[model samples]
Each structure stands twice: as C-alpha cells, then as structure tokens.
Target: MTTNEPRPAMTMRQIREGLGHIEPGQPDPIVQTTGYTVSCLPEDHDERWTYTVRVSYRGDGLWSVQCRSQYVDADGKRSPGFCWSRGPQEPATQAEMDDFDAEQAEWLKAYRFDHVTALRIAKQLAPTLTYRGRTVADALAEPVA
Candidate 1:
C-alpha cells in the first residue's frame, strides 16, 4: 500500500480474506511463491462453467441427488460430466476431465437432497446465480442459447 507499510505485501487480514487461507506467523503463500505474477486465472482457461443437479429416485421412492458439472475450455473443448473415480475410466465416467485439483471440483460434491432440501438450495442460490449482471430468472428468461 503506502511506503510506510511493511514490505511483506500481505497483511494477516489480507491473507485470510483475499487468498482464502490463514497461516499464522508463516509467509503468505502468494507472496512466498517464486513469482508474484498471477494468483487466479481470469476465467479458468476461458471456460464457461456450468453446474447441474440431477435427481433420480431409487426403488424406495426417495430422491437420490447427483451433481454434474461441465467445463468448456477456451477452445470450446468440453470435459466429460463425471470423472470422480480412481484409475482408468470407463466410457460412462470418462466425460469429465477437470480433476487436476480436488478443490476445483469440491463444490459439486455435497448435495444429498430430498424435496425439501432441494427447495432450500434452490431458494438460496436462485438469488445467488447471475448471468451478465442479472438474476438466474432473468438469465433463464433470455432466449439466448
């Protein structure tokens, strides 16, 4: 910031809020890196990310919720929709390829929902999801493909 401030570049507050972590009394991870060039990619390889929730019912008639996420890279290349298992992939699981880091795919993992739970999430995220500075409903209302 100002010349009077310390040269470490990141305050404890900055580390917790900006980089999303706190390592008390340790060097800031971003400042400790070899190069202080970039922190996060602009749009994650120019990809448009999409999150989908699929609900299926078992024989018992309870809804079994699953999530599918697709990432389309800058070149308009898309990853398969599911790739969570270890080892060589079968044709069905081969649709996803964004597993380079576990944290990237972590958001899609925790969604076990019934009718009530699904409605709770929908109510919360309906206001949260935005496209081009508009709400999810507005985005859906647009005829843009």
Candidate 2:
C-alpha cells in the first residue's frame, strides 16, 4: 500500500472504477480513491497533505479512503507523504504521512476481513477446496437440519 512513486490527480469516475474492480459488487469491502490536489506543493520544498473520507456501515463496519503524495524539498530531501496545499501553504514536514500510516495500520488490524470474504477469495483463487475431500461450497452447504 506504500509507494515511493508520484502520480497525477485522479478523477472521481476513475476512483470509482478502481474500487469496483477491487471489490466488484461486494457488500462490505474497503474502497480507496486515487489522490487529487486541492492545491499544489512548491517545487522547491517537500510538503504533505492528506484527506480521509470515512465510510461507515451497519454494525461496526468502518472504512476510509486515504490519499497522499511526496514532493522534493529545497534541501534535496524527498518528503514522503501527500503534498497538497491548503490556504496556499504546504506542511513543513512528513509527520502527517507517518501518522496516517500508523493510523491506517491500526484501523486495518481492527477491521480485518470477514469469513465470507476469506471464503470467497479462496474459492476464486482455486477451483475446489480440498480441506476434507470436498469443495468449499460443498462443505458449507452440507445439511445441518
């Protein structure tokens, strides 16, 4: 999820498409948008800015869209984080990006993937589940009545 590369601002449609591809029509899956600039960072200095779009679902479903950037500093040090300007000013350091990374990790750990999601992914990767000599669907669909 961390990239040292820089990219251009992305449109809303593009963001939606990217999310769709990742989760398809899943009822509960995290979606992220491509970063966009509310303003630009100076070419002479490294700065960062971040925006988090929180999405909540019923029964403790928490998700967020995080976007960031990195820019070159006057001292030739590369600032690693989102580089956006609010009110025509850039962040003085990369602290924001560091903080965001830590927070994101914590959130992910707390909101780990669900059972159905795990099963679905496993099924998609392989044709059959051989856990007990039966496919996953077969195993789950066994009569319990």
Candidate 3:
C-alpha cells in the first residue's frame, strides 16, 4: 500500500532490540564530536590580557588546534583579537594522533611561559585577522612588556 502519510519514528526499545546487546567499555559505533579549550595568562601580561588553546574535531576524520589572544581594557572594552589555526588534519595512524596532542601541548606551554614567542608563531601562521577593516595582529605584534 502506497500512502502519502509519514512513517512513525521508531521507539528507543525497538531500536535497541534491533541492535542487540552492547558490551561494557566498548567504543560506540557512532562517531563523537569533541572539543576543549585551555585558557592561560601571558607571562608578562596583566589580568586583562590572556590567551587560549583550543582543540576541536572538524568532522570527516579531521581535527584542528588554535591559539588566540584576548584583551580587555579598564573601561571593559574588548578587542577583536587575533588567532591562528593549525589544521583540519586527518591522523591516519596512532603515531600521528600522538603527535597532534604533543603539538597542541607544546603551544600551550609556549603561551604559559614564553608569550612573545607564541604570539610570533601564531602571527606567522595566520598573517591577517579576518575581522572588520581593523586587524588586531598589529596590536598583538607590539611589545607586551
């Protein structure tokens, strides 16, 4: 019978029954999207100045890591800021996955202990800020201390 009516959605019980039992500690068949950010103050900057390390999945077996600098003035005015993204990388091997984590950690460490160098590296990676006519990279390039 070909009817124009929409099919009813399957209930949870019916779906689970079709899939059978699942073992404990087993990875889920469905892919999960995950992300996190680590914020830290620059070695030489005051409380208003800080940076963040971001790691996120960009779908289709790809991941990305980014670092960004932020600032807020005493009047509570915020700057557009500048940022750099590393990759939408596809790690085909376990070693490559490990390298990804290591690289992100290294950048985090740089921001914590060597803010100037980290900003320099980020500037090199992303030369222009994609905001309004004003580019925050110039502000970031100026001496912090």
lDDT of 2 at 105: 44
Ranking by lDDT: 3, 1, 2
User: In TM-score terms, which candidate is top?
Assistant: 1
Better of 1 and 3 by lDDT: 3
Task: Name model 3 segments beyond 4 Å from true.
Answer: 1-12, 15-32, 40-49, 69-145
Model 2 TM-score?
Answer: 0.16
Query: What TM-score do all the candidates reach, one by one?
Result: 0.26, 0.16, 0.23
Give the per-residue lDDT digits (tens) of candidate 2, residues 58-143.
12232212122323222223234332323323233457325445545443444323434423332333332233355435544555
Alpha carbon lDDT of each predicted model: 0.37, 0.34, 0.42
Clashes of each: 3, 5, 0
Q: Cα lDDT for residue 63, model 2?
A: 25
Shift in Å, residue 116, candidate 3: 27
lDDT tens digits by residue: candidate 1, 29-141: 46321111111112333212332323343222223233234322222233443344554332223244444357434423332234555444433332344435654455445
Candidate with the greatest lDDT versus the true structure: 3
Q: In candidate 2, how many Å is residue 125 off? A: 0.9
